[model samples]
Target: MADAPPSSEKSFLRRLTVITQPVLTRIAHGSAPFITTFALIHLTAPVMANLGGTSLASQVMLLGREYYQTPFGEKYLVLAPLVIHPLSALLKRVLAPKPARRLSSILSVTGYTTAVIVALHFYTHRVAPTDPSPPIYAVGPSELDYEYVKFGLQTWPWRSWLGYLGFTAAVAWHASEGMAIIWNTWLRSYLGGPPGTKRSRTIGAFLGGVLPVATGMFFMWREPLMVFASHADRFRAAFSMSPFYWY
Candidate 1:
């Protein structure tokens, strides 16, 4: 039960970190665009709702879901990036020569937090209804429209409102910053940006785009439930599946 020599342990770690850095960085960066694309598609749902109400929103959501929720898209585009990006980033940070400061950076903080929020959202929307042990038909694809969001807000006004607002803001900001980083790092020459410069304009554009969606979603959440009322028991069961259920 003697410990391995410190020098040997340190040497092994150094080799592993050095060898993995580039690979991890590539994986993290490569998966970013897919996540960002989905984020944009997600933002669109609320905007459509704002402009044309739940009817329009449901149409848009279902259309987008047809692609991302499909087996191929879910595996390669949605689930893969969702798992790979954060995991790669986390491994990259842990393996970096100086990990302490890098892990505390805005990109790192927001990236991880956004990942958690997105996972919870996916579970509530996709996993809960289809759960084999107990089905929540109120939240199922066949019965639930996009306005199930309204049901959530109505059920837990403060928690739902705050959580949605924070999640949207973080996602919007993180995605904008991530895209800017990508542009500056790889596309500066082709895209006409100075290398090493931050893109406030990109951030501004993303925030502006999300603003309407946030407003629309907030109002939509506030709107009275038109369809969810009939399935009160199932709706409650669905809400119970939310990670924020206790809150």
Candidate 2:
């Protein structure tokens, strides 16, 4: 009689097929469209900034910047609507059951919609204010000016704060979930032994939760920290710059 496959071996095979199946499908269909979308966004940002407020190009670029910079912005703004919507739908049909597939589709759509709203909020507060004001440091690499950052914070006060909070929470949840999925698909294979399983899950959870919180804290505290640093009178006078300068 043929020997029975060990329970662990069976699990490994199931996971391996689960992971490789989607990868193969993507490869066969090609990933060029997704690549193109990212390239377009990158190429467009500077051109739009250069064009400033007068032209459509500039407006488009501003929109891109707003979408790209927000929390969970990358996934929802760029990937979900642009790439993952279709990918998730396909995956749902192929891998998930009816309810799971539906949930995945709903989440992807909801995530994308939230990103759009957040992007609009950013545009109204941050990007719109800069219009008609000569593009600050237009010739240099894109950098956030301390004044602009402060102005943004002060512009809508409560609304801005709420938006930031929502953005941060969405990002944290989405990113952590994505990481967990990837972990289960890839890392679990090599680290499947009982001794390492718990450790792996713990590490993954920590990374998923901690990274988003840290990012939110950074956004909240960054301006104050910069302002405090600017209080050195001697340094400010010598440099003819405020302590708040990003440097």
Candidate 3:
């Protein structure tokens, strides 16, 4: 067997955990509301697209994006939580005195997966189009609408279809678990009880059923032309910068 850590090292690690645990917990918990709010708005777009049409969906999305996409809101509300929550959770795990429980482990996996997917989604839609160095394309928030979404879906198996499916499922599952955590820890008194397994599973089932259907409905419509057809070359150039270019 390998030798144990020296006593001094163990003492230092214990000290570090004491210093950081509360701060990390606060960050992970405090930032959750912002993430949840954004998620609710983002998820609603697909559903509205299903019920009303792509135009309605675009309107819903734009309403939310107008605020969160602003510099201050994006920095403090969206980007910071996206980066900090996962990092805080990770640090907590590393400093933990023992292994995480099974549910916690599952949450970690889903949470990390969520961070990657959200980052990629933000970059592809928001950043790549506005990138300056190579000057691939110059679409701003006002220009991105259902047409941009339909362009992605139109590419079918090779582009974004499966990615959307996975995104919906992963986000639903992760969000359900996060809600459960909030109820159990923060709102137990007001809510009267923890979200027991039955209630949690019910929420999971509801999200799993609804979100994918919304995603499917989104794919049903077709854009009259590909995204930025008049500027196809620039669109392609910007899209090519995506890590999921071949996805």
Q: Using TM-score, give the best candidate's number.
A: 1
| Local distance difference test scores for all models | 0.75, 0.43, 0.72
Candidate 3 lDDT by residue in tens digits, 1-247: 9999999999998898888887888889898888888877777777777666677778888898876888899899888988888888888888778635553465776788878888888888788888765556476666677667666666544457666666666677777777778788778888686676846654674666456545545544543543545555566666667899844
In the range 61-94, model 2's lDDT, one tens digit per residue, is: 4567675656687666554554554454355456
Q: Highest lDDT: which candidate?
A: 1
* Per-model TM-score on C-alpha atoms: 0.86, 0.39, 0.85
RMSD of 2: 15.6
How should the candidates be ordered by lDDT, best one leading?
A: 1, 3, 2
TM-score of 1: 0.86
Sort by TM-score, best first: what order?
1, 3, 2
In candidate 2, stretches whose alpha carbon ends up further than 4 angstroms from where it belongs are 1-114, 121-146, 193-247
Give the residue spans of candidate 1 off by over 4 A.
1-13, 132-139, 195-206
Q: In lDDT terms, how accurate is model 1?
A: 0.75
Preferred candidate (TM-score higher): 1 or 3: 1
RMSD to native for every prediction?
3.1, 15.6, 3.0
- For candidate 1, list the clashing residue pairs, or say none: none
